[model samples]
Target: MALSLMLRNCPKLKGLSALSRGTFPVSRHQNFTQLVCKNRTALPLAVKCHNQFVKAIEPTRKMSADHSKLWSIEKLFSLILLGVVPATFICPNKILDNLFAVAVVMHFHWGLEACVVDYVRPIIVGPVLPKLALGLLYVVSATTLAALIYYNQHQIGIGQTFRKFWCISGTPADNEAKNQ
Candidate 1:
């Protein structure tokens, strides 16, 4: 009777040990199959969405390519040389320089305008102040350029002039103390 009990208990204990050891593998298999099924179900939906998006953008992509090809390499180079080189080197009155400066400032202003229009809130008060400030800056830059042209025809001492223009208001002692 004891032997029968011992034999029955041994099989139960063995089964319990086997179950403890097999738990992780059985759970992992279940999880893996669940993941596979989820991915299989989602794959077709993702592919269909991607196809639809590509189809929607196809016409725009072709239009952009066609527009981009309008400016040939030779034409672009010629435009750059004609616009930039004479502005920097050949013009003696600095009119081209002033025009270039104004153009750059206007370009910056337009870029800021585009950014504000695209991303900023129409009712937000913060962007309005910055836009006004940028306008003031453009005016100041243009005025400074005009003053430079009026006062100095030759480029002599221009570096010294710039240094003086940006000179700090503090004494040399204050600069030395700050450096340390």
Candidate 2:
């Protein structure tokens, strides 16, 4: 019903019915826009429909100071990661290892959080599931960060671990010989 109403109101969707019914013969010469709507109406209606759709899909929100600061911080952290990653690999130590672990886990957390916020919206998957997903993300991120930190502290650091893994050869004895 809503789709039919949208089709009726939007002049551009006039040929949708014909297209659906297979009566509208599509030709290579005719552009998709031409096929969709041949209506020669004023541009205002199309603009109005577009604005309405945008408003409906994405509700406007006033950007707070904290949001702006967080955005800047995220961008800065990403830029820092570019340097931290290579530097950690080149000079693997306690400080660099811990830094690498924290940086990577935080980056992963932020990325996953963004995905959860964007895709697991209340409107799409109901209110409870979205909250639950976000909570689970936090839990997983915390656990991962804790594990990485523990590994860095207790055993070989992330950089050394990766370096060791990268140096793998045909056999364990061959690896040991190469290391020695």
Q: Which prediction has the highest lDDT against the true structure?
A: 2
- Give the per-residue lDDT digits (tens) of candidate 2, residues 1-180: 577556545754443333323335667888757755764442444555566566554535554546777778788889889999998888889888888788888888888999998899775688899999999999999999899889889998888988988777698798788879
User: Model 2, 44: alpha-carbon shift in Å?
Assistant: 15
Clashes of 1: 0
User: Under the 3 Å rule for N, CA and C atoms, how many clashes does model 2 have?
Assistant: 0
Cα RMSD to the true fold for all candidates: 20.5, 9.5
- Candidate 1: C-alpha lDDT: 0.51
The global C-alpha lDDT for each of the candidates, from Candidate 1 onward, is 0.51, 0.76
The TM-score of candidate 1 is: 0.28
- Give residue 67's error in model 2 in angstroms: 2.0
Estimated TM-score for each candidate: 0.28, 0.64
Candidate 1, 65-174: lDDT as tens digits: 56345346435554554575355544434455545444444445555555654455333556586567566666766676666555445663233344555667689899
Please report the candidate that would top TM-score against the real structure: 2
